[model samples]
Target: MSSLVASAVEYMIDAGQRSTLFLDVLRQRGDQYREHVAKTAPHVLQYAAELIVDGRDLIEPVNYALVRIVPPEGVQIDLERRPFVVVDPRAGHGPGIGGFKADSEIGVAMKAGHPCYFIGFLPEPVPGQTIERIARAEAQFIETVISLHPRADGKPCVIGNCQAGWAVMILASLRPELFGPLIIAGAPLAYWQGVHGKYPMRYTGGLLGGSWLTAMTSDLGAGKFDGAWLVQNFENQNPSNTLWTKQYNVYSNIDTEADRYLEFERWWGGHVNLNAEEIQFIVDELFIGNNLAAGKILMSDGQKVDLRNIRSPILVFCSEGDNVTPPQQALNWILDCYADVDEIRAYGQTIVYTVHQSIGHLGIFVSGGVAKKQHTEFSSNIDLIDILPPGLYEATFEAKGEATTSADLVVGDWVMRCEARTLDDIRAMGGNSPEDDRRFATAKRVSEINLATYRKYVQPWLRNALTPQMADAMRNLHPLRLQYHALSSKNPWMFLVKSAAEAIDGNRKPVSGENPFLAIQERMGKQIVQMLNSWRDAQEALSEAVFLAIYGSPALQAAVGIDPESEPARPRQMSPEHRMMLDKRVAELRSRIQEGGLREATLRALLYIGSARGMVDERSIAALRQVRRDHAAARLSLPEFKMLVREQFFMLLLDPEEALAAIPKLLPADDSQRRAAFVAMREVLAASGVVSGERAVRLRRIADLFGVEGDPQLSNVTSFDRDARASQGGENSQGLEQHHVG
Candidate 1:
């Protein structure tokens, strides 16, 4: 009886504590809400930004600005190393996410010792700034970064996140000479390409009766489009999270989660506006027309931005789980732009992509884990990526510490590898079918017509009605903005709630995790989420169905100028200049195939072996770099090295049999030199990790061609002296060296 009374007393005390804690949490939320209102009401960034540009001047002033990333205290930056320039998306939100946290894109680059620059924009865009003008401004920013870092190895490595992805791609195409390597994360290039049932965002324009809404909204804003609508669309996609889970999550762990929630909310709430012309161009040219990938969109300068013209290495980072820019949209441009792997090679373009199995779109830029691993590895190997031969490859990572069973979160040092990939592989990643392409083409035509009609019929009236003052008033009254301003301390009623919350906080009591009411609350929250999800799914299905019905009709198809009976258009053909460049390259390779010495021979053999495996890792490349450093005669300048690598790779492509046989001719007849070359080659293969059977066979064939005898296993040659000592007991390293090279 005494024990039961003690238990009851304990339970009552816990219940009271929980009740007080809940009230205190309510008060804290009010405080947070009030703080958020105060911060956002000013329409300025709450975070401190310290610029890094040598001169605090925009060489070509537009809305955008490029600032050097000031590394956190205690972090040293190497200006001589390749500079990393991160261009954050300008879609809806204001700039800063790329450098928002220590474990972010800029942070990773800073940690890697690269001079970092961030491309950001102001609260207000330059009046009448077009995407073309923005691209030019970005180019000027990059040129300034390049000028500032004249001592750096190559051109700046540019990273474009989300909306900035396409922006950089345009810049690269226009000025490929200015970029060394490009990393585009979570940016959609193929906007019309998405899975039918899974990706519903693609149908939105069609469901809303095409992109005329974009124009209408912009016009109503009196020449500026409110970005909050774009943010709202993103919110509406996941009703469960927007309506229930997000709030409930904070409520459940209110004490611990409030700071993080508020920090992210600060950025989320800070919406920026775009000029009417800019939004219209993006919606018409990219979202609806999908012309960028097709290489058909003519810039203001009259030159088409052909992606194939981008000569620098391109790294595309995307995620399968990114509903905003699905992997298909992120990657299907390869199909739109190139015919096959051979064509990519012929164009002298190196395209490498990495796809995460499951990370949301924003997580691709903001997640610290992604920064620590993918971004870190990419930065560490930026030089390697810059020098990689022109081809299509997929960058994959293997954990370095996975051998230790206790290592749970295997991060930090990672083995970065690039494996050759084909268009077929991209197709398997949910590449759109011909019918889907045709439907999107139809949507594009409908969009053009609607936009034209809107401009002709409705835009003038809206323009006449909307003054700048009226636009400002309408923007302020936006539901999304109103929500933030509503509960603010600006409301006289909230002061009482704030006072009560402070009192509750002083005597705060928290509930136990095992409380019966908490359990019921969780169950209720799950049910609400389920209902919201069901509604979302039903709404998406209805939208998709309606889109198909309207856009897929025979009459609509004819109206849009697409012939139902016609075949899909062929992939873009290589330019005459591109073809001539390939032809000249082939001639050069044929002429120089037999001109290289043992260094070239070994490199050729390694390329042959690596090609068979389709994968090359960092360890192997590092080992190869060490070999170049160790051998005086083997050292070459960057330009010479890149030329030789390209020449060797082309030779292999031209005639593998001839290239392999020609290896013996390039090497010295002396056994010692041949043995040294063999050992170096084997070291590279071994450092690349375990050699597959096919690679081993190729290694043997290269050995035979070089007139080297005995089994040529990579392990035997990795440490010739050690292997000799192990095989012949008591044999010293000196004896093995003599025996092998003599």
Candidate 2:
């Protein structure tokens, strides 16, 4: 053979050998997996079976007995005035993730002295519970909490994770008064949304031809939907982790990683079923149909499920690396639901979103880092979010050992600032698409058809076939269940391998590395995965393009009774009651603004504006307070004071010199107080890094007018010494109380 052909042959041969060797290793790993399963499965099975046997205790332990809060050892449950209800996602898994760690969302709230309640459920659904029933239960739970904490704020701050996000949104929409601040983390609102060529989960409905398959599966299970299907879908999203990386990590760190894996798997493997009705509704109304944002979803009671109707401030925490629910899906609801920021403002909605660059979906809720940073910041500053002006903002958390006065006080490792962004900026992140609407519309139709067919044909037969015994067996036989079951003593071979594997586990010390080989393998694996993902993207794009070409054509659109060019007409005339209610709300808000002094109003405005900019240095906040205090001290007539404050603020943007020059005019007329105020203003500017030699001279010159002597070195005070006293009576008044002007 020629040289080129020989090289090709060698390459093919090597590829085959690599494949064979890889398969051999995998086969050995599989045996190890089975052996590991034999060893560990019994404990899981026993744990789960105990829960099943003592179902009440398993589902509702005694510690959680009094509203079910089991405080950590050495800790007492101290209830704060505000009640906090944390709802964990029941997407595919069992409960307790939100409270799995002591420093979790529940923990943060609990530590902050809030009465924390965890909303958890059993691995099995209650015999005939539906989504509405669950929602009602949750609402009732919140109401009970509210009744218990009579002195608490209006209602409990309801935090919903992942799947619970929509459930919370639905609950809040259905009964707005029952909720306080609604914090939704890693929840997909605009479910049909995604960056082009990424987030394949959105495409699954289109590929599967809609939610009818969900109905079919539920029917197959004889009325109860299998949650393993959802877990399997999650696993499929990251095949390397599901198939290899996860097991390898355990094997590589067998001694230490085992407990963590088992702990996580206990919840991950504990699959919970949903009623066919519930899953079908979710897929059709929320995921595939995208009706929630469009104000199309209606409750059984006939109230339109308009997300905009939710009165509480909505806080969204999403991540870019979350393949299951990307930032686009989390944030696009704003763009879809409202015409503009003014509409959101008009409705008195406070919407805040934080986007992390790379945390996965689960980490948003479960990562301790996230708990310490995002969750902690959010829990501590929820009141801040509640008071935010109606607009969109990106919440940023920065870790600082010493926070400026402007930083909102938080309980944990980081302080957060809210930065505002335009709706157009949000739109630029990848939403502006009609294709999504088209695809989701198709999914909705196909789902309806399939569901109807399954109900008509398959329902009766499957229901008859599924006895309680059969259902139990099916649940036990589920792959997630088997991993636990096979490790149990119930397995015939488990006894033989259990002790031996335990011994091996004791002796088996892994060869540790800053493993260059492992690192290289990981990098290469990621590159390969990315390439495969790229290929998948190209395929999907081509498929969508073809689909749109065929179905989006004029002929097909007409055939389907869809008018591509048609627009939703203007909203129907507002009823007098609605108009009066809206007008009343506006008048009340305006009245509140009027009643609130300009100082309060300006501080609120500073918060609203500063949060949008992403960074709020000490200077901005100090300036805001100084301006407010100056205005108050000057006792300028309300209108003059407002204008003076406005001019100073406007100058703050245009000319710092002009703004500082304008500040002394707002000072108190009393020489002593005026001098004190000038010194205070100097300290504020110094803290904000706005004070300089020239600014110091101007300040001192102004202070001298009030009979206050200036320190010669004040011009040299580059840093604001936290301990150093501002000159009072030309000497340090060490014990004097420092007055806060703002």
Candidate 3:
């Protein structure tokens, strides 16, 4: 009994010590937040960066700027390699979250020897700045980057995080030529897509009766919308994490977690402002109207932003735990844009997607583990993605396992495999039903009506009533803002806390893991989190229920000028023009079905095998690269290779039988030349171990087309003295001169 009392007393002392450390961490975070907010151009980027281009100086000025990341000590960057440009979302927070740490997107890309650039914006939007100007600025930035690297191997790779994802997509569709492989992390493209009970953010517009409130908020802010509201919405989505879990995590590991927490909060607390027009367009066109993927958005210059128009290989990375941009919204854009994989191929677009099981939206771009793994592999395989045949693929990465073949070919610890996917594959991941679409359409209509009504009835009084000074007061007095102010040294009362924290830091005594009191505290914290989560879930459920009840009414739909029983709102498809273009393209490809020699034949063979297996792995791709490096007399630029691959793929897709038969005609007549080509082809085929199943059968057919028998496995690789076309007077460099739709 005496020993138990002694232990209990010891537990109390340790708990008191840990509590002090936890309080000190919060005090430090508050101080950091104040410092960050007070700065004129504050950012949380851990890396030192040099300014490259300021968009405010452009022809049509914007707030965004481009900065080149200066690599840290021991990190090397190669100007000749593709440059990586990371664009951070401007939904609410200040920029630089993309490079918030050393093990971030910029870090890994720089570590991989690629020069990196970041696109950030000031806390205030430039007067009259719009998203269109911002996008044009980004295009100019890429052009500037290209000008700087005159001899780069490939075009700059653009990675867009969260809100920046859709913005990048808009620009890519507008100016596809300026981009290489495009990566969008945790970005929602299809606004109306989500599971039945999950992702309640999609239901927000419906419950709020549209973007009228957004307009009102803008009015109240005196032509600028406060981003604090956006941040608040994000917080309300996960109450447990926002209110308790995060702080508890810091408290539990205060000694190691303080600096990281403080750094993140510095950016998280630095809210920015968006022009009323900018926020309105985002809400009306993207959130409520669901128009980006539908190709209904047209720029001021009158060019339609068509997802199908983007030829740069698009890589989408989303996570299941990402409430902000769940996999449904991230990936369903494919369904909204194209009818099928054949249409995707016809458009000559390559798309790849990866879904993480549990990483949240911020973690998708900010987590060191994700950067070291997903971002690293993405950086390493930019070339492979660039040269992929126009189609839809699901990219997956796995650690080295017993089944992994040609492990030496992979540069990293994980091997990436891209399996061909169909529209059905995307459909399997849950999307809005036709009924759900009608409801959302009704909501959209209602939103339009409400906004019109508000402008006519409410705006005049509210616009004149709220002055700039009043707006500033409201922004500063926001709960999100007030919290930082209350805890900072700006508050006279916080001086005591700071003094105590400093004293505690000098004599910190964190509790042992086995402490009984610490366990009880942890248990209580978990219970509080559970309570908060329950409230969040209930609130979301109520919102969804209210939205459905109000918008699901047939009477309301009729009043809103929508047919409840009619076909849902499909994407804006320019059927006749697109069909004519496709037919013309098909005719051109068919005309050249029996053209070229080894180059055309090799591409056709690979496309044929890929179609047969419906999958592609790293080994095959690596071997193909190796064969080109060893055998080809002249190197094919990325554009040239992409064109050749697409042309051959189109040939096979148009008429598989004729394409295979023409392979023999395309081959060299000399047996030695044919053997050299055939052997090199077989070497790539066998790179992923013994190719069996339908792929092997396709391989044998390709071999037969070249008049070769017997399967030559990986070990039987023969070095081609030179490319057949090169030796035979560069026969019909098929795709070198022709420019496709950019």
Candidate 4:
């Protein structure tokens, strides 16, 4: 009887503590929401930064601005290395996710000792800032960055996050000369590509009667579209998280989660406005029309955007878990842009892509783990990417350190490497099929009809009914914005809650994790989440079904100008002059196969081996760069080195047998130089510490061609092993074994 009495008293105390802690958290959240609203009321960035390129001051004014990140003390900048330009997504949310914290995209670049620039925008867009004008402003910003860093080794490595990904791609295509390499993370290029039942966002346009709604909304906004609608759509994508899980997680762990939750909310809550013209262009040319990938998007100056014009090596970073921009949508543009691997190579364009197994759309840019691993390696290997020969490849990361017991040590840090991949490999990753193409084509046609009908009948009424004051009131009173304003301190009713919360904060005690009632609360939260998820799943299914049924109708297909039997058009054939030029180039390469000195010859052999291996490892490339720095003979200009690489590649393409045989003649007759070249090549191959059948065969073939034995000491040695040996006075260029290359 005494024990039961004690238990009842303890239960009362626990319940009282839980109540106080809960109220205290609610009060703090309200305060934070109030602060966020007040802070962002003036169209300011959440994070502090100095503007470097104000598009308003440019010849063609745009609302976009380029800012230089203010790095923390002790982090020195190197102006000689390649600069990194991170363009944050302008999709509804305000800027700064790329640099919201010290462990982010901008932070990663800064840590790598590279000068970093951020491309962001104002809250209210310029009066008539079209996508084309914005693209031009971005080009000018990049050119300014380039001019400032003349001593830098290459052009800035441009990174585009989400919406900015397609923007940067357009810039790279139009002004390919200004970029060194391009990274597009979690960005949708192939807008209409997605699986039927799995990815439902693609069906939203079709279900809503096409982009007519977008136009109507813009009209209602009185010239500018409130980005709150876009934010609302993103929230709705994961109803379980939005409706219950996210808030509950924060509430349940209020003591530890408040800061992070508030920081993210500041960025998430700060919505930007876009000009009606801008949103209309995006929905028409890219989303519904699917014209960007089709090379049908006309610029402000009448030039059609062609992705094939982009010459920089393209790195597409996507994730399987990104529902908003699925892997299919992120990468399917490659299929539309290039006919085959041969065409990519023939055009001298290098394309590499990496797909994470599980990470959401926002996490691709904002996740700390991604910033540390992918972004770090990418910044460190910009030079290697710039020098990589034209081809398609896949970047893979392998962890190299010992395991640890910490949240930060997930499989230790990783080292990035690339492998040769074919278009078939990409096609296997949920690539679009002919039937899917036909369906989207039909949807596009239906969208045209629906949009026409809406404009002809509804737009005039909307124009007359919508006033700027009404638009402002409607935007502020949206459900998303209403929650913040309603619960904020500005509401007179929240005054009592604030006072009670402050009193509770002074004497608050959190409930124990093992409390029975706490477990019940968790269970209830999960139940609510499950219910929301069920509703979401049902809604998604219904929407997808309706979209498919409407767009799949025979009458709709005919009205939309789509023929079910027609096939996609083939790539255009090369002109006669272009063909002759390529033939002449091949001939020149064949003639000069044995003309160059030891430097050129060694590079030719390495290129031959690399081509055979069909991949390049970042560590090996790093060592190669070190070799270039160490050897005066290897100090060729970027253009000269590119020319040499192209010539050798063409020589190999012309006749592999003759190219391999002529490698010896291009080298010096001196045995020591031949041995040095072999040792260097072997060291690069062994840097990753793993050998495959293809690499082994190529190394053997190269050794046989040069009539030189691989060094036994360097055989199968990891990069660490070589470093240790060198530190202990080991031979750096010992002779290699005859049979084994490494």
Cα lDDT tens digits, model 3, 568-654, are 655446478878998898898899999898888977887776565566677788898898898668568767887898888777666
lDDT of 2 by residue, 428-489 (tens): 87863564465456556656666687778977777777776777677667776666555555
Candidate 2 stretches with Cα past 4 Å from truth are 1-66, 73-78, 401-412, 458-472, 505-556, 566-578, 585-742
Clashing pairs in 4: 710-736, 710-737, 711-735, 711-736, 715-742, 716-742
Clashes of each: 5, 12, 0, 6
Tell me the TM-score of model 4: 0.90
- Candidate 2 structure, TM-score to reference: 0.73
lDDT of 4 by residue, 261-380 (tens): 767777887788899999989898888888888788877678768888788889999999999999989888888777777777767788889999999988998888888889887877
TM-score of each: 0.89, 0.73, 0.93, 0.90
Candidate 3: where are CA atoms >4 Å away? 571-574, 710-742
lDDT of 2 at 474: 77
Q: Tell me which residue pairs clash in candidate 3.
A: none
Which candidate number has the best TM-score? 3
- Tell me the deviation in Å of residue 177 in model 4: 0.4
lDDT of 1: 0.77
Better of 3 and 4 by TM-score: 3
